[model samples]
Target: MNESSSRRLELVPGGVQLGTGPWQRPTSPSWVLVLPQTVGLCSSDLKEVRRSRDVRSDFGHEMVGLVHSSSMDDFPPGLRVCLDPHVPVTRTTAFSETTLLEGSPDQLRAALPTVLDGTPDDRAAFTEPLACAVNCAGKVLAGSDVAIVGAGTAGVLLAVLLRLKGCQVTLVNRSPERLTALSSTALLREVPKVLISEVGTRTFSTVVVTTASLDDTTFDGAWRLLSRTGGRLVLFGGIRSDWRVPGTHVLLDGIRRGEDVRELELGGRRALVVGTHGATGADFAAAGAVLAAPLPWTAGHIEELIVGRVTLPGLAALLNDAVRTGVDPIGKHMVDIGLNQ
Candidate 1:
C-alpha cells in the first residue's frame, strides 16, 4: 500500500463505502498521521456513523499513529501520539498527542499544575477510553455503592476504576454473557465486592448508566434501583429521543417519597445528571495516570476483556458484522495498523 494513499469507509445513501482515494494530504502547517483502520471498529465509532446525516463523514477519531510528517516545530517524525479528536474551542494548536490545549488562559494555567512528565507516546492508544472512565469514576464519592448499567468496554472499565476508588460495584447488563465476561477479568475480581446481575432490584446510593440501548424498560429499571432521598443517577450513555418512561411511578414513589432520583455530584454526595459528550484533556491526563500505575487485576482477567484483534484491511468487515448481528465480539476489539499486522 502507498503511504500517501488515503483509505476510508464512507457512508453512502444506502450502505458503507470502503476504498482508497487520491485524497489531498494535509496542508503545510497541518500534520498528518496514518491512523490504522483498526480504531474505527469501536462502539463509539459505530454510534457516530449511525447518527450522522452525511454518510461521507470521517468516522475514526480515537486513533493513534506515528507522526508521518509535520510542519509544526513541537511535533517531529517517529513520535507515537494519540489524537485528541475533540479539540477544545479555545485551543491554539490544531491537536495534541494526548490532551487538548484548552483555549482559556486560566484553564491553561490550571493545567500547568498537573501536567505529566512523560512523552506523548508513553500514553498508549487506549488512553482516551481509560481517561473517560476515570473522569466518570471521579464523579462518584468514595465508599459509595455504585451500579453500572452497561457491560460494554466503557462500562467495564468504569466498574474497575470505581472499585479502585473503594466503591462496591454491581455491574448490571441485559446480556448475561457480558456479565460472564466481566467476572473473568482479574481487575474486576480484585474489587472488594462485585456482583454481576441481569436483574437489578435493590436500590443503591449511585448508579451510572452507560449503554446505547436505553428504552422505557431500562429507564424504569434504573429508577427502581435508586435510594429514596440520597440516590444519584449519572447517564453516560446516549439515550434515544423516542425513549419515554411513565413519570407517574417515579414521581409518586421516587421523588414524592423524597427518594431524590437526582443527577450525579462529582466532588460531593449530590446526585448528577451528565450529558453525553466526548472526553476532555483533563480526562485524558487522569486516565494516563491510572494506566501508568500497576493494575491489581490478573493477566487472565484482563485478557478476557479483549475480544479480538484485526488488521486495518479487515476493519470494514468487522464493522459490518457488528451492525448486522447487533452483538460485538466478547469484549474490546483492537485494530493493528502497523506493517507487522
Candidate 2:
C-alpha cells in the first residue's frame, strides 16, 4: 500500500497547531485505514490535548468514515464505519475526523450494525460518544434521581442517556452558556438545568462527574450531591487530587486518584470510575447499533447538540477552548478534514 498523508492536530502551549504528516498503516491485521467523513469533538479530546499544549493530541473518537483499506474481510474498501479507540487494537493517538484513522475490525464486528445503514453520515458521526454515553450511563438503574456535573459533551450526553433509561437528571454546570446550550438541546429540553450553587442543597442517587474540565470542585461537590448511604458516584473524566470523603461515602470500584478514599471502611456508598474498564468489541457493537436506532433521544439529539462545523484550518479557536483546562466548552464540535483537498 502507498503511504498516506493528512493534516494533524498538534497540541501547542495555548492551542492546536495544524500540520501535515504521513499516515502509516502498521503491520497489524485488525487495523484498517479510514478517511473520516465527520469527526465529532469530545470534551475528552480537549483534556488530552490540554494535557500539555507542548504535546500533540489526535484524540478524536466520534467519527464516521469510509474504510480506505483493510486486510480483514469484515472491513473492506468503500465500507462506511465508525471507530472505538478503546479497543486494544485501536489504542493509538489522534484518530478522529478528517485524518487517516486506523480502525479495529473487532470493534466493527462487535459494535456497529452491518453496512452503516439508516443514519446519515453527520448523525452517525455520534456513534463513538454515544457508545461512551451508553458505557457510563447504562450502569445506573431506572427511577434513580441522577446528577450529572460539568455540562460538557460527555456530561450532557450522560443526561440524555440516563433519562432514556427512565432516570430523572439534573444537569449542573458553572457556565451559563453551557447551560443555555443544554436548555436548547432537543434531548435535554425537558431535563432540569441547575447551576453549581443549586446542587449543594439537593441530592441524587447517582452522580456522574462526566466533566472534561474543572475536575476538582465538581468532584467534591458531586460527592456532596450524592444522596442515600448506598448511592453511586461514577467519575468518567477523572480527578486530580486525593481529597477525602469523610463519612457516608465508599469507593466501590474504578481508578482511584484519591488517598484515603481507597482504604475506606464504609459498607454502603459506592464511588468508582466508569472509564477504568477499557472499551471492548461489545462496547463498539452496541455503540454502532445505538447510533443506527438510538432510542429515546435518538440521532435527532446529535442534530440539536452539534453547535458548529469547521474545516481543518478553521479549527483554531474552537479547539483552543476545547483544550482549555477550566473553561466549560459547549456541545459537539465537528472537524471537517476537507477531504476534497
Candidate 3:
C-alpha cells in the first residue's frame, strides 16, 4: 500500500496551521487505519488555535470513518463506522488520512454492526457528543429547572437531551446568532447576552457550566444560579483548576470547609462534574439510542445546527480567525475530508 499523504491540522504556538504530512501505516495488530468522512468543528477546535502544541493536536472526535485496513476481522477493509473515543480501543486521531481506531483483542470479535442513526454518515459523526450529552442529562432529575450555559457543541446537545427528558432547560450564550439558531427548534428557551448577564439573579435547581472556562464572570454567574439548598451544579465543561483556587483535586459533591473551594460551595448545595458516572461504552450506546428513537417535537432537529462543511485546511483559517477576533462561529462547522469508501 502507498504511504498516505494528506493535509493535517497542526497546532502552532498561538494558532493552527495547515501542513501536508505523510501518515505511515500502522504495524500493530491492534490498530485499524480509517479514513475520516466527516469531522465536527467544535468549540474546542477554536481553543486549540491557542492551546499549547504539546496538547493533543487531533481535531474533531465527532466523526465517521471508513476502515482503510485492519488486522482485526470485525473491522475489515471498507467498513463504515463511528467510534467512542472514550473507549480505550479505537481512540485514535480523527483528521489523519490513515486514522487508527484501536481496540482490545477481545473487542476485535466477529463483524460488529456499524453504528448508525438512520442518518447520513456525516450526520452520524454527532453520535459521540450526543452520547456524552446523554451522560450529562442523566445527572439531573427530569422536570427540574436547569440552566445550560454555553451554546457550543456540549451545551446544544445537552439542551436537546434535557428538553427531551422533560427538564425546563434555559440555553444561555453570548452570541445572538447561536441563540437564534437554537431557538428555531424551540428545544429550550434561549437567553440573549443581555439576559445572560442576569442569569445569576434568577434561581435554578441546577446549573450546568459548558463553556469549559471558569473565568470570573462565568463562575460568578454559575455560582449564583444554583439554589441555596439541595441545588446541584454540574460541570459539563470540566473546571480548569487554578492555583489561586486551591487543590488539584476538586470535590464535586458535598462541601469541603477548607480554604480551597470554600467559596465555591453554596448553602447545602451539591456539585457534579457531569459525565463522570456514565462515560462508559454503555453511555455511547445510549447516545445512539437517543438519536435513533423518535424524539420530541422540539428536540429532534439537533442536526440543523450544522451550518457549514469545510475542508481541513479551510477549517484552519476559520478557527484561526475565530480565535484572533474572539468571535464564535455561527454554528457547527462539519469538515468534509472527502474520505469516502
Candidate 1 residue runs with Cα over 4 Å from true position: 34-40, 51-58, 88-123, 191-201, 241-245, 248-276, 297-304, 325-327
Higher-ranked by lDDT: 2 or 3: 3
Query: Native-vs-model 3 lDDT?
Result: 0.64
TM-score for model 3? 0.81
Query: Quick one: best lDDT, which candidate?
Result: 3
What local distance difference test score does each model get?
0.55, 0.62, 0.64
Candidate closer to the true structure by TM-score (higher is better), 2 or 3: 3
Which candidate tops TM-score?
Answer: 3
lDDT ranking from best to worst?
A: 3, 2, 1
lDDT of 3 by residue, 1-341 (tens): 23557666776776777777677456556767777788787655666665622334445567777777777777777777776654445444565455655556655431123665466765577787787777777778899888887877788788778877878877776557667666655444443332477455678888887774555567567767777766776766644433132223444322211111223443344553343322556667677676664555644456666878888778878877887888767767788885542
The alpha-carbon deviation from the true structure for residue 242 of candidate 2, after best TM-score superposition, in angstroms, is 5.9
Q: What is the lDDT for 47 in model 3? A: 60
lDDT of 1 by residue, 1-341 (tens): 45545555555443345666553444333334333322424565666445532222325545555544444534455545554555522321111111123334433333222223442322254666676677677667899988888778788778878877888888777757666665646766643233333344567888787775566667667656677657767666655443443542222222212323344332223444443345667778777676554566543322245667765457667766656676555667666555444
Reference-based lDDT, residue 259, model 3: 12
Q: Name the regions of candidate 3 deviating beyond 4 angstroms.
A: 1-4, 52-58, 89-92, 106-113, 186-194, 199-201, 243-264, 267-278, 298-300
